[model samples]
Target: MEIDVEQYKKDLLAQGAEVVFSKTKNLTDTPFSYCGGCGHGVAHRLIMEVIEEMGITDKTIGVAPVGCAVIAYEFWNIDAVQAAHGRASAVATGIKRTNPEKFVFAYQGDGDLAAIGTAETVHTCNRGENIAIFFINNGIYGMTGGQMAPTSLIGMPSSTAPYGRNPDMHGYPLSLTNLLAQLPGTYYITRQAVNTAANVRKCKKAIRQAFENQKLKKGVSLVEIVTNCNSGWKMTARQANKWLEENMLSQYPLGDIKVPKTDN
Candidate 1:
């Protein structure tokens, strides 16, 4: 006899399991346009979940930069603005300053954040902008083909680096999140992934904390999600995940880099 998966899920929900999975009200019902096995969808859902849970869906603003997530304004139910390439941080700063009561966040990709927006990112954090930054670090430029990004692994091959990246020539992979943590203006910074169910839960918690920090006016909060770009990596979804665990995790470990002081 075949097992009734749909009924099983219904049973679980009826049993008061508190919905192991459900679409957040903060996102549109339209299906996601991300490539199969892409982590952007997961990251989007997690952020929306946090916003819905916090009951701030109407009071939050998101700034999406030019990248795979540039269309975020269409997906997210809340008010969202599009920023020029690598300029999400600067746009978010202006929005938060002008509307201090609204919670503002910027969603950026590694290429947009670590390279073109480096100056804006550092300066915004240094100035203690009360905004959250959701950084998606997939190591490659997913939107513009598989090109090397500032956070790409040292020896990772990309369209631009067919023979793998040479640290001597390309320099080393930038750890922007870690660098941001060192700034006194930043109150919270963390690196997370969505490779597993457990990791997904942890990521959601970190995102929620970032939102809470904004409500407390605790300065800048940066949450870096080290995700997999299967298509850009030229690997199957499963293979990409495995490769990320073996290689990416070693260079960009998962954990909270910094947290707000309890005494404060």
Candidate 2:
């Protein structure tokens, strides 16, 4: 039977179904711990929605990386484990390997995943770990000052890059999706954002696809979400959104870079 995606979403909204960000039992109420205009909050909500909709709350184990979302375990009401800086993928691999029956997911920021955690992320995908990875790419490190992350765009200014990112000196920013796409173990890889309503919907869909792929015991699935950090970016929440829409989107084109036809 064909599923009516539109009607299904409407029903979920009408039933007062609590997943994330609604009034009752919403994930947002867990606390406004994230900085204003931070993409982590939006990403958090999408993950919660996917878990609730898939009914995998009980069987899911989320690995939270050491970055801005270091304490994501506290906000997400699921089996969450904290990993050392840039080691969430390694931890997630262990958990998924040991508990094959459970669904494992890893969440990490640009610095954690693309910089320090690069080896783990690549090896995990190379091994085809049956897990979902939610990667937040905000260009700058939001937690320990606004430093240049591996994903920071060219000419983008950060605390570490006072003048802006210089490819000659700092090297090119890493493209998480493009890098993972070269690996055969990666069943799905997509780049999404949360700067606008349309993009938010796309991010949720990408996240949902990642979860579904993991449930099917498929290879690794990575969803890189270009999020915002208003405080770190030194812009108001509204201005940050505008900046992302005007600048970030061009560098990080939105869409799935790879997905096995069988998985689709």
Candidate 3:
């Protein structure tokens, strides 16, 4: 007889087996369109799980950016709005100001946040808007072709930078998270990765802290998850992940940049 994994897990839950893992209720059943081994799906699950665990599923409002996560509204069960390219931060600001009681967050990619929305991002944190920002930095622009993004490391090859990214001609990789950490308006700022189990747990904790800080009416909280873009990078998922470990981590080392005095 064929065994039913889903039903088996549920039956085990009924028998009071220690709950190892389960899908969050805040995520829709729609299949994700992310490329194989892409971190977007994992990121979505973590965010939804946090929302579900916090009992804020109803009061959460997400602003989706114009990159790979442009269709994020469909994947997330929570109410979401689509922002123009590089305008998620600006749009989220208006949404949060209008609905102060709701939890507001903007999800963006390197191209959208560091490149196009740089002004909005800087001003939002500087003003200390009571909102959270989830940034996914995959080096290259995954959607709309693999172009060289502001967060792309030096010498990284991209469609825009065929030979290689030259700092003299292209400028250095932009560290937006580090920049925002220095701003007094920013209450919490951390960078984590999703490639390893340990890092996933750390990222989840960071995300939880981000939302938790909002209860204190603190300023902007940024959680930057540095991930890999296998499709954009022209490598198999396994190879891309290995490359991310060797190269990406060196440039975007994961850690907390700023935190409240209580955490300090």
Global Cα lDDT for candidate 3? 0.93
So what's the TM-score on candidate 2?
A: 0.89
Off by over 4 Å in 3: 1-20
Q: TM-scores of the models, in the given order?
A: 0.92, 0.89, 0.93
Compose the digit string of candidate 1's lDDT tens values, residues 71-137: 9878898899999998999999999999999999999999999999999999999999999999999
Report every candidate's CA lDDT. Answer: 0.93, 0.88, 0.93
The true-versus-predicted C-alpha distance at residue 47 of model 1, in Å, is 0.5
In angstroms, give how far residue 262 of model 3 lies from its true place.
2.4
Alpha-carbon deviation at 232 in model 1, angstroms: 0.6
Where does model 1 exceed 4 Å of error? 1-21
Candidate 1 achieves a global lDDT of 0.93
- Residue 137 in candidate 2, Cα distance off native in Å: 0.4
Clashing pairs in 1: none
User: What is the alpha-carbon RMSD of candidate 3 to the true structure?
Assistant: 2.6
lDDT of 3 at 134: 97
Backbone clash numbers for all candidates listed = 0, 0, 0
lDDT by residue (69-93, candidate 3, tens digit) is 9999999999999999989999999
